[model samples]
Target: MKLLMAAGIALSLACISAAEAPSNYETYYGGVRVDSDPRLLNHYNRVLAYCDREASLPQRGSPYPYDTWHILALRSCLYRYSFVDRGVHSYPANWFWGHVFEQ
Candidate 1:
């Protein structure tokens, strides 16, 4: 019975650690999970802020004129920022699975 209890405790700990582990995307995209690099993380946050500001700005031309362009530009900037910070060229292929399986 003692052995079984110890095993159960170990298993629970393992599950907790696994759940807390950073996802591949967080590590890959802009190093958000990187606690050691505050500078890079701050820059990533600044970029996101800038993107939000730009997206919220009103355009003067046609209705929704800059919507497509803004989205594309923001996406490009984010991808470039992530690549620069994390040195990862591609998004995690398993990102979807990670979220689905976690819950």
Candidate 2:
């Protein structure tokens, strides 16, 4: 559930085109999301890293549970990019039949 949620969050921030958006998370994606489609790897890995970072930061013995706002903001940012940019709003669903057919 966490992985999927994270993937959804990250995909929201991904670029719709190779030329669009900054390549801020591409390197991270290069390491994860093993699949036949190179594009899926690019999308999933980026989201995975962002979530890992966000979730891990709060786990390093913080005095308080990490701020929900910060986490929500991350997901919101992803949502913004997804909606405004019409980018990959979700994970492999973008590559699935319904989503792919929409393209």
Best by lDDT: 1
lDDT of 1 by residue, 54-79 (tens): 54554511224235444444544555
Tens digits of per-residue lDDT, candidate 2, 1-103, equal 9999999776654423321232322223333223445775566457545643554454432222244434444444444334122236323355566566887
- Candidate 2's displacement at residue 98, Å, is 19
TM-score of each: 0.33, 0.25
Task: Flag clash pairs in model 2.
Answer: none
- List the pairs of residues colliding in candidate 1: none
lDDT of each: 0.45, 0.43
**Residue 4 in candidate 2, Cα distance off native in Å:** 32
User: Cα lDDT for residue 93, model 2?
Assistant: 51
Candidate 1 Cα errors over 4 Å, as ranges: 1-35, 57-76, 83-103
Which candidate wins on TM-score?
1
